[model samples]
Target chain A: MQTNISVDLGGTNVRCALVDENGTILSIVKGSSNPEKGAQAIVDKIESLIKQLDNYEQANAIGIVVPGLIDQEKGIITAANNLPKLIDYPLKKQLEQDLGKPVILANDVKAAAYGEAISGAGKEHAIVYYISISTGIGGAAVIDQKLLSGFHGFAGEVGNVIVDPHYEAIGIMNAGAAEALGSGTAIIRIGKEKLGQQIEHAGNVFDLAKQNQKEAQEIVEQMTDHLSTLLSTIALVIDPSIIILGGGVMKGKDVFLEALDQKFHAKIFDAMRDIRIEEAQLEEPGIVGAAMLAQQSVSH
Target chain B: MQTNISVDLGGTNVRCALVDENGTILSIVKGSSNPEKGAQAIVDKIESLIKQLDNYEQANAIGIVVPGLIDQEKGIITAANNLPKLIDYPLKKQLEQDLGKPVILANDVKAAAYGEAISGAGKEHAIVYYISISTGIGGAAVIDQKLLSGFHGFAGEVGNVIVDPHYEAIGIMNAGAAEALGSGTAIIRIGKEKLGQQIEHAGNVFDLAKQNQKEAQEIVEQMTDHLSTLLSTIALVIDPSIIILGGGVMKGKDVFLEALDQKFHAKIFDAMRDIRIEEAQLEEPGIVGAAMLAQQSVSH
Candidate 1:
C-alpha cells in the first residue's frame, strides 16, 4: 500500500503520477514527448515531470512503462513502434541513475494488465489475461499478482496472433492478426473502406452501427468475431480465471462487449466457458500498473 | 535424483515406469487397458502394472498422467475423450488410498513437456513448449522447469485453436482448429477425400508425398502449414526458448519437420526467430514426465 512514482510514456505524451496501493492518483503531470528528439530528450522531460510532482521524495520507487517491448533482463526498450527512435534504448539505467531511486521498466499494456490484476476488475482473480483494444491490440497476463513476462519479453504478445490464415497483414505481422482485424485502427480502416466515407474512429463506426448503418454494423460484427477468435486462442494457450478488455476502443463497449463475450464463450470448450470476460475498471491503469511494477521490483 | 514411479494412462495401454531424476527409465511395464470397463478398471490396471515393476518400493513418489483435461485442484479427471467413462473421476485420491503413497496427477502432454524441460530434448532450456500431433493436436508448456497448469487445466489445449475460421469441423471443435486441420486424423481424412482411396494413416500420406504424388504432397503441405500456424500461435503467447514436437505424427518428421520449422519461423516476428523447434528425444516422455511431476510435488 506504499506510494510510488510512475511514468507512462506513449506516442502522444509522457504521463507521470504518484499512485498509492489503492491505485489512486494523488498528483499528476503530463508533458508532450517529441520522441523524434531521441532518448536523452525524453529522459530530460521525465525529470522535469518529476520535479513538478508533489511529495515526490516520499515515493518508494519509480516505474516507467513504454508502449513497446522491453528486454527486461537488461531493462531496455527493445522496440517501441510509435516511438520509433527509442528502440534499444536503456531507459531503466538512465532513470535510476538520474532520479537516484530504484526504477522498474515495463511494457505499458503489461503494466495495465498488472494494475487490473491487482486493483481493478481482476483483483480477485489469481490468473488474469488482459487485452487492450486500442489503435492497436496488445495483451499481457498477470499470474498470482506477478507479471509473467517471458524470457525474450514476448509472453502474452497476442496482437500478432493470426485469427485467419488466408488474410494477409499489410505489415510484418501475420495475415488476419487480431491487431489487424479487431483493433481500433483496423475498425477505422475497415469502416472507411466499407462505408466509402471518412470514419473518424472506432467509436464513430459504432455510432453508425447504432444508427442502423448496415455496412458499419457488419464491419463491427466482423471485428467482434475476430476478437472472439483472438480471445479463444488465448484461452487455448492459458486458461486464466478472467480476461479483461481495456484500451481506447473500450469506449464503445456498450455496442459489442456482451456479444463479444458470448462469441468467445461459444468458441471455447465447454469447461472453459466459465472464464469471465470483463471490462477493465481502473481509470489510469497504465500509470498505476507501472507504480505496482516499481513496488514489485523494490520488494523483490 | 530420486527414482519416482510414473503411470502414463493412454487409450490403448497403461504404461508404468520407474524414472530417475535424469529421466532414465530404470524399469518399465505396460498393460492393455479396457477403458470401456470404466474408471475403477483403469485404476486396477495401473495397480497391476505397478506391481510388475522391479524395486517399486524404492521409488520416492507416484505420478499418474492421463491423456485429457484434469481438474488439478481436485485431482480428478475432468474430461478424457479417449477414456470417456473416466470423466469426473478422482484418480489421485483413489491411487493414494490404495497404494499408501502421495500421488500427483497431470495431463500426459504436459508431463511430456516437463520431461523435456528437465531431461529430454529441451533439457538445456528454461522454457519449453511441447506439441503432440497425433490423432489430435495437443500442446503443453513447462516454464522454468515447472508445469504452468492454468486454473482450469486448459493451459496447453491447443488442439481446439482455430487456424481458419471459415472451415467447419466435423466435431465440437472450432471449424478449422489446428487438430481439425493439422492432426494425423485430419491428414488421413483429407487424403482419403482428395485421393479417392483408403488412406491407412498419416505415414502413408507422407509416403505418397515422398513418391511424388501431387495430391498427397498437397495434403501434406497443407497439414504442415496448419501445424506451422499452430506453432507460431504458441510462440506468440509464450515465446519459449525451445519447442518440442512429439506424438505419433512425429514419426513422419523426416518428411515435413524441416519445412514445418521453416514455415513457423517465417510466420513469427524477426526477434523471435531464435526459438528452437525440435523433435522430442525421450523414448517415453509421458511416463518420464509423470515421474518428474511426482518429484515436483514431493519436493514442494
Candidate 2:
C-alpha cells in the first residue's frame, strides 16, 4: 500500500498522521499553531509535523484540511478565522515545496464528509449529508461516491441557510440556518446570554438538561428544534439516503439525535420520512477524510 | 434518431408531442384530461393522442410527465394534486399496455429540469438547478449529467423547504420558501388577503408595482425577498454551476428575475458570487424533459 501523510490544521494545533490505503493511521504526530508568531510560524509547525511522519515512510502525497473558505483549485487559503495571516497564501505550493511531495488542500468539514463517505458511517449510503456540530456548524455532501464541491467549492454550507427570517440577524444567522439555531457556538452564545454562565460547556448544558435543569433543558430543546428544522430542510432538498451527524456536541448526545429525528419527521413532507439519520463512525473524521482524499487522489 | 412519444398530463389538458433524439418536437397533439369520466377515460385520451402521433411516425418509447409525487420504480402516480384518481395507479404499466411500448414516468418538474439540463439553458453547465415558478414553486436538480432523485425519487422538492418558520400556514406558505414568496399561488393568496380582488392576476400586480402602487410594490418586494432567501439557501447548499429559472411566472416577467437576482446576490455569501443564474431556453421544458427521459431510458 502506498503511504501518504494527512494533516488537520486548526487554530490551536496541527495534527498529522501517516495513513495507508485502507485509511489506517500508522503513526501520528502533533504540534501547536502559534498565531502570535505569525503565518510563517504556522507553516514551520506544519513542516515539523510533516518531518515527524517522514521517518515512518517516504510520503507519496500529502493532504491538508484547514478551517476556512479555501480556494481548492488554486490551493490558496482564502480566509480562516483562526489563521488570519494565512489569507491568500498559496498553501499547497508552499507545503509541496517544503515537504517535497504533492499536496492537496480542502475545507476541514468537507474533508470530514469525504472521510465519512469513503470509510466511515456513510460508506453504505450512496448519497450522504455529513454535518459537524462543533465550535460552529459545518457541513459537506457526498453524492454517487464523489464530494459535491459546488461551482465555487462552497456547496455544503448548510449552516448558513437562514431558518428564522424574522430575526434581525443577517448572513449565517438567518432563520433557516442550522448554525444560527443549533450549532455549539450558537448554543454557547445563547446560553451565556440567557443563562448567564450557568453552563460552562455545551456538553455541560446537555448534561444539565439531562439532569432536569429547566433553563438548560429549554435551551437544548431549542437547539434540537433548530437541528430538526435544518434536517427537514436537507431532507426536502437533497433527500439523501442517510445523514451522518458528528462533531463534539454529538459525540455522546444520542437523545438529541432522537429529538432531532422526531422533529424532522414532524416537519418534513410525507414523501421524505424514510431517510436514516445516524452518528458518524470515525473517531476523527476530518483526519480520516484527509487520508481518504489523499488515497483517492493517488489512486486516480 | 429514435422517435419517442412524450405526454404531459396536467389538470385540465393532456398534451402530447412526438420528439426526436435531438429534442425536436416533430408533431403535437392535445386533449382534455376529463377526470370526471374516470381513469379509463384518461387512458383512452392518452391512447387517442398516441394514435394521432402514430399516424405521423412510429414511436420506440413513451414518457409521461405527471404532476405530484411519483413512485418511479413501480411506475405509480402515488398522489397527484390535480388528478385525484391518479393516486396508486400503475401509470407506466397501463401506458405500456395501451401503447404497446416501454414507458417511463417521472415528476413533471424533474422532467423539465432534465430537459433544460440536456438541451436548454443548462447545456454546458456541470450542475443545473431548474425552478418552475408557476401556480406553485417546483424544482429539480441535475448533477454531473445525472438527475438527483433522492433515496425515494424525491430529491429536488425545493419548494417544500421552509422559508418562514414562524408563519402559521403549513406546506408551502412558510415565508422563506420560493413558492410562498414568488409563486403565482402566493401572489394570488397575498392579493386576495392584502389587496383584495381589484388587483387580480400577477400581471396586474406587476403593473401596479410598475405604476408606483405602494401596497402592490410592497407585496412584490416581500415576495422577491422570500424568493431571494430560498435562492440564497439553494446557492449555499447546491452551488450549481448555473441556475435555470423557468415556469409561467418567469417567462414574461423580466423584472421579477432582475429583482430575484439582486436579492439572491445580497443574501449569498461572498464565496459563491460566481454562480450564474439564467433563464431556461426550452419553450415547454416538461414535454421536452419527458422526451429526454424516454431517450435516456432507451440508451441505458
Candidate 3:
C-alpha cells in the first residue's frame, strides 16, 4: 500500500499530488510553473508544490511527466520548447535531491497512455495507443500496462507523422505532418485563412462548421482526412487493440468525429479496420499515469 | 543442441529446413507447392519436404511461415491469396497432427523480421523494423526478439498506408496506398504507361533511370518520395532502432538507395534523424526466421 507522488509539469502550470494504489489523488497542490524563468526555478516550484501536499512524506516514489524528448534511462529532458532550459537538464537528479525520494521521469503523453491502459477506457485491452490533439499533437503506446519506450525514447511521436503530401510545413515538423494538418493550432491557422479577423480558436472553426459553413466545413473535412490518414498509418504499423483520443481538439470532435471515423474506415486496411478509436476517459491522466509510473517503478 | 523444423510456404514452392539453435540450416529440402491445388495438397507437400530433411525427426519443434493473414494464437491461416484455400484453415493443428510435432505459424514477413531481429542485421538492436519491397510491399516490427503481432495480427501491413492523394487505386487498397505507388507491381504498371509497352519488372525501370532516362527517372523519383513518406510515417510512430529493407526491389537498390535515403532524411523528424535504414543481412530470412519462431515456441 505504498503511496506515490506524481507531478504533471507543463509550461503554464504544475500539479503535484499524493496518489494511492487506486490512482486516487489524496492531497493535491497546484501552482504556476512559469518555466520560461529556467529549469532550476521550475524544480523549485515543483518542490514547493509538493510541500503543500499533506501526505507528501508518506510517498515512496515520485514520477514526473513532462512534454518533450525525455531520456528516460538517464532521467533527463533533452528538448522542450516550453521549458527550453530543460534541454540536457538532470531534472530527475535535481528533484530527487530536493525531495529525498526515488523518481521516475517519462513523456507526458506516454504517462497518460499508461494511465488509460491501467484504469481508463483501455483497461480491458492488452494494447492501447493514445493520441492527444491540442495546441500541439502528442501520442504514446502502452503494451500490457507498460509504455513502449522505443530506442531513444521517441516511440509514438506521431504528431510529426506526415498525413498529406500537399500541406505546408509548420514549426520544426516537416510539411504535411499530422500536427501541421490536424492539430488545433493548424485548425486555427486555416480557419483564419477562411475567415480573416473573425476566427479566434479551434472552437470558432468548429462552431462555423457545425452551422454548415462551406469554407469552415471544407477545412474541417481536410482535417478529418489528415487525422484519418495519421490513424490509418498508425493502424498499419502498430495495430493496437484500441486508440484513445484526447486533448483540447476533442472539445470540437463532436463536429467531425463521425466524418473522421468514416474517413479512417475508408482508408484503413481491411485487416486493421477493427481498431477502436475512443475518447480518453481519465480526468487527469497525466497526473494519474505519472503515479502509475512511480508505483510500477518500485519493481523496476 | 536442439534443432528445429522450419518450413517456408511460398506461392510456388515449399522449403523445409533443419535449423540449429544458432539458426544455421543443417539440412534443406525444396519442392513444388502448387497452392492452386488447395490447402490440403499444399500441407501434404510441406510434410513431404520435411521428411526429405535429414534431421526432420530429430527436430524438437516446427515453424511454418506463410504469405497470408495468420491467426497465430488459434493456429489458423485466416486469409491468403497465394494459398487461397488456406482461408480459415487450421494450418498449425492439421500440420502438427500430420507431422507429429508441435507447430508454430506466422506471417512470412513477420517471420523474416524475427529472423533479422534474432540473428541478422537487427541482432544488436532492441527494436527492428523489416520492410520487403517486392511485387507487393510487406513489413514487420520485432521488439526485443519478439514479433509485435498487432491486435488482428495485421501489424506492419504498411503497403496499404496511403502516401498520396492524387494517385489512382491499384487494388483493394485505397487510392494512393504505398503499394499503389511504390511496389514493383505499381512500377511495372506505371512503366508501361511511360514506355508504351510491356515492362517485365521493377529492375527495368531502375536500369533506365540509371542511364538517366527522364521518364524512368521521374517514376523512380516518385517511388522514392512515396517510400520516404511511408518510412517517415513509420519513424514517427515506432521510432525503431533500425529498419531493414529486403525483397526483389532491393536487387535494384544500388540505383535508388542514395536517393531514397536523401528523400527520407529530408522528410523525417529531426529527433528521429538517427534511425538507420539498412539492407537485410540474411540471404534466406524467411526460412531462418521460421526456425527461430519454432525455437521460440518451445519456450512459450
Q: All candidates: CA RMSD in angstroms?
A: 2.1, 3.3, 1.9
Q: A188-281 in candidate 1: lDDT tens per residue?
A: 8888888867787898899999998998889878988999999999888988999999999999998899889999999898888789999999
Please name the candidate that would achieve the greatest lDDT relative to the true structure. 1
Quote the lDDT for B28 in model 1.
86
Best by TM-score: 3
Q: After superposition, how far is residue B292 of candidate 1 from its true place, in Å?
A: 0.7
Model 1 chain A: which ten-residue window has the lowest total lDDT? A164-173
| TM-scores, chain B, all models | 0.93, 0.92, 0.95
- If both were scored by lDDT, which would come out higher, candidate 1 or candidate 3? 1
Candidate 3 DockQ vs. native = 0.76
Cα-based TM-score, every candidate: 0.95, 0.89, 0.96
Off by over 4 Å in 3: A34-41, B36-41
Candidate 3: clashing pairs of residues: none
**Candidates sorted by lDDT, best first:** 1, 3, 2
lDDT of 3 by residue, B1-300 (tens): 889998988888888899988888898888998988888888888888888888678898998888877888889887777887777888888988888899999788888888988889999998889999998898988887888888888788899998887777776887889988999998999999996575788888999988999999999989999998988888778889899998889999988888888888887666677889999999889889999988888887
Weakest 10 consecutive residues of candidate 2 chain B by summed lDDT: B169-178
Candidate 1 interface RMSD (Å): 0.9
Q: Pick the candidate with the highest DockQ.
A: 1
Off-target runs (Cα >4 Å) in candidate 1 are: A34-38, A52-54, A81-85, B32-45, B51-54, B81-87
